[model samples]
Target: MTTTAHAPLLETSRALITSLQEPGGAYPASPTFSAYRGYCWFRDGAFIADGVSSAGEVASPSAFLDWCAGVVEAHRTPIERVVAAAAGGAPVPQEQMLPTRFTMAGTPGADEWWDFQLDGYGTWLWAAAQHAARHGLDVTRWQPAAGLTVDYLLSSWDRPCYDWWEEHAEQVHVSTLGCIVAGLRAAADSGLVTGTRAEAARAGAEAAMAVIHERGVAGGHLTKWLGTDAVDASLAALIGPLGVIESESELAAATIAAIEDQLCTDDGVYRFRADTFYGGGRWPLLSCFLGLAHARAGNTARAGELLDWAAGTATTDGLLPEQVDGQLLAHEYRTEWIDRWGPVATPLLWSHAMVLRLAAELKEDA
Candidate 1:
């Protein structure tokens, strides 16, 4: 945990966390400064706090913490809106991955894809629950948001909003449902949203997962999407967070093992599949989550190595790019949408948080 050389990593990471925040104590979804009135999102909330938590007080993700608490505190109204929106023939938040503000709230300019993910609500639930559990905060602090999130997931999982790729869909994609399941499982475990809500979260996650297992398992590996034989590293999110897959399930073990053996580059970044998508680019978040998958499954040493590799791709400025080419360490930028502000910055809050969570493992292993 006490790496003599990790000082710069910690310092840079802290600096980035400080920069990513809105002055009033919220994250603006992405660093992609925009004119369209951006707000915090499920993805941002999860990772922004994660990054700060990992910075080890070198800097505080407290801006993130304040944002989460404030938003969670305000949950009663939004939850009502969310429920009303769903009940009144509004679309169920299908996991577009936005925080409540952008999801239910209106956006003027281009707000598509990144910020309005309905599945993101589930992630918000998961992150809040995890934040409460990890920090030993009062679980009740997260209950309502967590509860509404779970209810939302169950009420709308089968319906379509947006896939992880942000494409509208009725077709089941692995990333969407997987994230939903992982997030809900987080809510259920948080001890805040229990009983029916917890059961529903657990069930939704399981059901979505069942869809994967029944149809996804093929040739001795977990397939990426339902009915498609794609092998995506994104599945790592489910296996990493749940901890259920790694311990007893042969499929989880084999799937992760396959990812490490094939998808993980020598430098530790993850390519979704070397043969497909965005020129077979390496995904930083997926790589970090791979480390978590290992760690969550009790393979600390392997996790440490993968985390080390993943850390290499982070810029000297501490912003984790969306992709770091494995063989050559090529940095790839996925431009977020344009708005009144101009071209968007892709310093995704999720990537920062992934690094932060990885840093937490360092302390624990120490």
Candidate 2:
């Protein structure tokens, strides 16, 4: 399908995202999904902000970045405490770190959650810097918070935290490390961090890159985490929008091949081989991420095909569900999740954001 064929859905997605943005600049994960309602994840919002920004709707992303900055600033004391502990070799527990998602009011979720992922903070820094650069806006507005994030990440980037899927909390995820490298590079390059901070950011990125290269690759492609040979759809992001790894590099090609051969089908991209969450259905957002990597690698035609597949997942109402169970990996597990958390999250902001992002990239390439 051509970009023209998907124009209506694209327009609806843009409108939906801007409309659902909270007054405080937070983008709720999903407006009506039970487990996701009333909270915003930094990782999800950053990508959403990047998508909205790329789609030529700037205000929503700007507001979201402003909110991100405010949230980080509000936790300055806790951040300093965590940093000091790490510096002193007495690192605090994972729960003591910042949460993975927050209320729209910019506080930690009142409800329990898998709340200690570090990828989101790095993602926010990357997205905020990219937004400022893309729109030619000043970056200083968020510099203080970005610096705080850098400090927080530098302290605990080596620790075992949750992966993007919120599982494997005991292992160092390669995708999470990619996010830190991207964010640190952005902060260092965009002058959002300077002096000793800039040096640290650059050093931190290099250190993370070294670790990724040293232990994150297997069979010439990126792996799920350090010391594993399994591949994940999320790995495509490092070679794409994240821009941590060069898209044109040999390793990028191997990773794309691995994900395509293993996790991707004609329908969509699965998160990982072992994933059974929501019956391990294919995710439209992951498809877009793989599409992005393909586009950046100069495979426009393949990229367009992936974009079309993602668009096909949208509901008749132009809403994209988190994942579709039509071709689930573990079909038997579907109903129990449904009984617990209701149906899969529909009108997921991250899903819409990714579609917007890939659509924009394909249109630009065309």
Candidate with maximal lDDT: 2
- Per-residue alpha-carbon lDDT of model 1 for 19-77, expressed as tens digits? 65667566665655453236556555666665565454422444454455455556556
Question: Which parts of model 2 are misplaced by more than 4 Å?
Answer: 1-3, 364-366
Kindly list the per-residue Cα lDDT of model 2 for residues 1-366, writing each as its tens digit.
344768888888999999999999999999999999999999999999999998887789999999999999999999999999999999999889999999999999888888789999899999988888888988988889989999999999999999888898999999999999999999999988999999999999999999999999999999999999999899999999999889999999999999999998784899998888888999999999999999999998898889899989988899999998877888888888999999999989999999899988887422
lDDT of 2 at 154: 96
Return the TM-score for each candidate structure: 0.75, 0.98
Give model 1's clash tally: 12
Write down the TM-score for model 2: 0.98
Instruction: For each candidate in turn, give its C-alpha RMSD to the true structure in angstroms.
Output: 5.0, 1.5
* Model 1 Cα shift for residue 351 (angstroms): 2.6
